[model samples]
Target chain A: MTIATFPPEPPPPPSWTRYLGFSTDAKVIGIQYIVTAFFFFLIGGLLAMVIRGELITPAADLVDRSVYNGIYTMHGTIMLFLFIFPVLNGLNNLLIPTMIGAPDMAFPRLNTAAFWLVPVFGTLLIASFFVPGGPATAGWWSYPPVSIQNPLGHLINGESMWILAVALSGISSIMGAVNFVTTILRMRAPGMGFFRMPVFCWTALAAQSLQLIGLPALTGGAVMLLMDLSFGTSFYRPEGGGDPVLYQHFFWFYSHPAVYVIILPVFGIFSELFPVYSRKPLFGYVYVAVASFIIVGLGLIVWVHHFFSSGVPQWMRDLFMATTMLIAVPTGVKVFAWLGTLWGGKLRLTTPMLFCIGGLVNFVFAGITGVMLATVPIDIHVSNTYFVVGHFHYVIYGAAVMGIFAAVYHWFPKFTGRMPYEGLGKLHCLLTFVGANLNFLPMHPLGLMGMPRRVSSYDPEFAFWNVIASLGAFLLGVSIIPFLLNMLSSWIRGPRATHNPWDAIGLEWLLPSPPPEDNFGEEVPTVISRPYGYGSGEPLVEHQAEIERRLQLQEAAA
Target chain B: MTSTTPLAGSAPASPEAAHGHANHNLTGFIIFLCSESVIFLAFFSGYAILRTSALDWLPPGVEGLEWRTPLVNTAVLISSSGTMVLAEQFKAREKLWLFRGFWLLTMAMGGYFLVGQAVEWSGLAFGFSSGTFGGTFYLLTGFHGLHVATGILLMAIMLVKSFIPGNYTGGEQGVQATSLFWHFVDVIWIILFLLLYVWR
Candidate 1:
């Protein structure tokens, strides 16, 4: 292998404006995604708060029915289409190149183009509100017939814009997936094999693989709906002799696996946070890595479970029920592996660690609910109830967003070259964890008591839990105050970070905090050992000192 | 690569070096094709569903659609793929002019196929607004035509790129990647031809 004898090209001038503009550099583009997605997260969170506020008294007191529909639909769509997916991709883009010691993604310009599409199309989606019929009100799935023939569809905006936005974002995400798969597969440091790669890269790769296979189906469905809405065609209009159930088949075929698309990378994040904080090797690293692939495979077929009550034949539901339950095996392996990784270890309950542990507890709760829901009878019992809502919030908000916080906090030092305020960070973690359980836990009993989801108003009998959930929603909204301040204040004038403040041994920690342009500075680092080789004294077998020595000499010569 | 081999030290290296510039592009391009195929399959699946569930495949007022044009279009597209294969073979032998010549042939044929599709589309008694049979037929072929148009654009770029001396001297990575994409477009049509034109 050739050690870079020449110095890196001088970095872009460190300025905030560079981020305001387009950059082919993955770091700049990644920060763009993180910041832009955070904006959407706030907007989506506020929409949820509005929904909760409207539900406080068990009557349609606050908003009209259609407006309520728009709020919930846009909330789900914004959070999924804008917040979770892009934020994870942003973090992955930031870390993958440096993690694997590559110069950039396989297609750097395409990466930039992908980042641009998120905001461009995201605005189109959010902009649908200002137009005639307001944004789509027929749920985030926007099932056809209603989507095809609704007043909103009859009007020139709303659901059609939503479809267009989804298609564009899907294309953007597919482009991102292509770059990620290529980068991970073909651009790893010379000695880094599939097994030797970081667990996060492995999970991110698996997630991208799922996105590759699954998202196209969603795109096709959206395009067909777009056609149905615009033209007089009947792809989904039953009156036109088009079967509306076919659209459900197409939608669930992609959206069910999309559940993994949201959480699998967080599984990677938890895997990273656990090993680092516990000062131990990740238990069953291979199993954890391979489990992600297994989940992706099972995830694709189990989609029919979402349609168990939608006139799918009994045998199909039975087969899908079997597959859905089967996914819990690989997923359970992950949870157990994390628990084992934490057992009898010298654990530091840093904010990131607290979130990971709390997220795991919530993840176990969510997984149980998931299995329960996988059973046909139980799923049929709670099909459109708040119970499914509660279950996903437990998994997604409780686990995945918690993981997002942990990652943001853990890597704040790396992203901004400053240590976030640990005290504020801990407060944010506590408020979020407590607030999430309080907010979503009541959803189960309420659903059992027959409270349907997607409603701004509820029956007066469901008042107690709805009130509690609104309080929790307020708490959850307030919880971000410290997080925002910690990040903003820390970014503006907080103390600078050491190159390896965590004393972590990943290749990313070996680079400059916030990393220099031309990551690794024109030098290609070779991996000499497995990524999680902690407690082995020298974690990275690639001699960090030797690379530093060469870099120093090159810089001096320059 | 030979130039860099001299500067390299005696270090343990895996055969992954076999993934030179050519293979890297090819691998990534193929992965893209894999995803693209899933998307096309979704549209194809939609067609299958609509066709099967239809009370009558051509419900009403959809009659007298000539199949001869699409048959010829299929032949034209299939022949273009053959020309693409020939172009690659010639490029591998460093037959730059022959490579360019055959690529032009492929692009010409692809253009002819698009024209044939447009003519067929014009002659048809249906449109995207027409019911499922007409809708899927128009949309699928329209989408495929868009891809073919993109393929022609890529072919045009390669034809122009051929003029730059020494561009392909290192390896035939760029052209091979584009040819793979063009062939994928061609392959999608063969399937589209059977589903949309034949079998009825």
Candidate 2:
């Protein structure tokens, strides 16, 4: 049998300009999602620094009250909607199809269309600031009455634009969800059954399921709010006998599960990375994969817990609290599975692994807080405080962003066809771990001390920890400079990566780094064996020969 | 788990299934409808709240409307589902002209329902902005109306594609997808009809 060939080196890589325009190719689209999402990350990071800077003292020094609201609102909105979610989507776009052994996404043009909506809405959201109302100052949640109370909600223009931006983004995400679900379900390579697929694919499927079922509720809420503000419709207007709480019910229905939409995909990244770095098959692989689906299912029901403080009747709160707390079971299965994978293995300690390990460490704490907060008593205590903020950031920034960084470090070689500088990557990882803890860890105490979040300033009594958190936030911010430098400097000058630099066994690693257009070149991969198969195998022997042949070809050419 | 043999577990579609179209278009379309139902659920929840909690189903300045015509329109919309099923069957049988005729007939029924809804709305004294009743009524029904319009437009596109020689040969996928959406809209109308007109 003829073996598939890998080119000696990536020949004359595609121009950087492919990143600039419309491309139906999934890789091209993936890059677009990543770069654009990173830009939004920077925007959100700058806003975070401004927030931390303002909170360093009691007074709202940097920006006034309304403006501070906009700043934080934009910070949260950009991070949640624009940055983290799309980055996950981008990573999925880049890797899932390749991992599944499909030529590209099920609907390539639809994928491209979904990607284009990001920029349009991201720009719309950012542009809302320059508009008369100065961006959705009502907060990302845009709790009605407060959101609809101000004509600024209508006339000031920012909240209106925010609603439009969010609604449009929901449409974009729905399109993407349809594509991802269809791709994973229908397009697996021959022999790659559902159970045999990688854990990452399973997580992607679960997240997409949440997106499919959950997002339209947000769309429904946004459409109602839009009409309420724009056409003077009363879907949320109490004077018109409308119930604002109903709107909250609709928004959180999507937004809470949406909390998972951002993280579950990253969780998959952690699952995939741990096994690769540990040189072990994902422990209890079926359990870990099923755990993700469980998270998805539990995620949908627990959204009501966000409103415990909103005067939910006793039975409703109890029901949601039970459901919310139940999520920890599946979550525990994953954490244990991760730990189990790490046990009894030759650990590589790569930068990617470091972030995953660190992220997992933080995730445990976050999960602890998650369970605590799921209780009605504890949640009501910190519901409006920075304690809640600390807990959330621990997961969102600490866990999810850490997973993103790990995925970035892990995939950077494949993406850029070059090795990132190890020293700088390690530095980046260390500073980020310290900074994430420093920035978010202290907020728990501040909130416990009655320092409500979204305040432009806090009392002087809370000043000390705020300073520490601010400094940590700055450290976190500074950590990215090294990452950007590492990627930029390496993409141009870094040594060309071998096909499987980490000796990982996955379908994607079989292809040359920075795979050619159309992904597998010509012949489609027929997947065999269990996912993450590590031992002696036909494909393994063939792949080793191909890599050696390519190395020898490069040697001969030189 | 069928981990040992790939062929048995894998989708039986060869590349000859034509440009990867058969992989999951029908399945994707169905899943999309399920999600769409959730969207309608949000509206239904709001409608249910308005129905039970609100003091009046017909708020101030919104007089009651005759239900007779809307009932007929509901029947018209539901019958379209029947035609849609026929379209799916004809396309699968490769009865091209029969499929086209039924497909157009389905589109016409959808159009008729939309117009019936429009006439009902015009006959009412309330507007979208009137009050909670008017707002929810117009919004929910309007949302459903837009979906019906979208389903018709999709079917219209299919009708055009059906006339082309190579398109329908791809199977009744186009027919199936359109029928799925068309029927889903019809199903939503039953709910909308129940809460909006019948309960009122």
> How close is every model to the real structure, measured as TM-score?
0.93, 0.94
For each candidate, the DockQ is: 0.38, 0.38
lDDT of 1 by residue, B1-200 (tens): 11122212232232333442223667778898999999899999989988888887785787746777678778888988888999899988988889889999999999999898888878776667667877888889889999999999988987888888887854466788788888888888888878876666
Task: After superposing candidate 2 on the true structure, give the runs of residues whose Cα lies further than 4 Å from its correct spot.
Answer: A1-11, A152-156, A535-558, B1-23, B61-63
Candidate 2's error at A423, in angstroms? 0.7
Instruction: Give the Å error, residue A325, model 1.
Output: 0.3
lDDT tens per residue, model 1, A227-302? 8888778888877768888889889888988889889999999999898998888899999999999999999999
Model 2, span A134-228: residue lDDT tens: 77778889988888755544464888889888988888898999999999988887678898788889999999999999999999989898888
Proportion of native contacts kept per candidate: 0.62, 0.65
In model 2, state the lDDT of residue A239.
83
lDDT agreement with native, every candidate: 0.84, 0.84
Instruction: State which candidate has the highest TM-score.
Output: 2
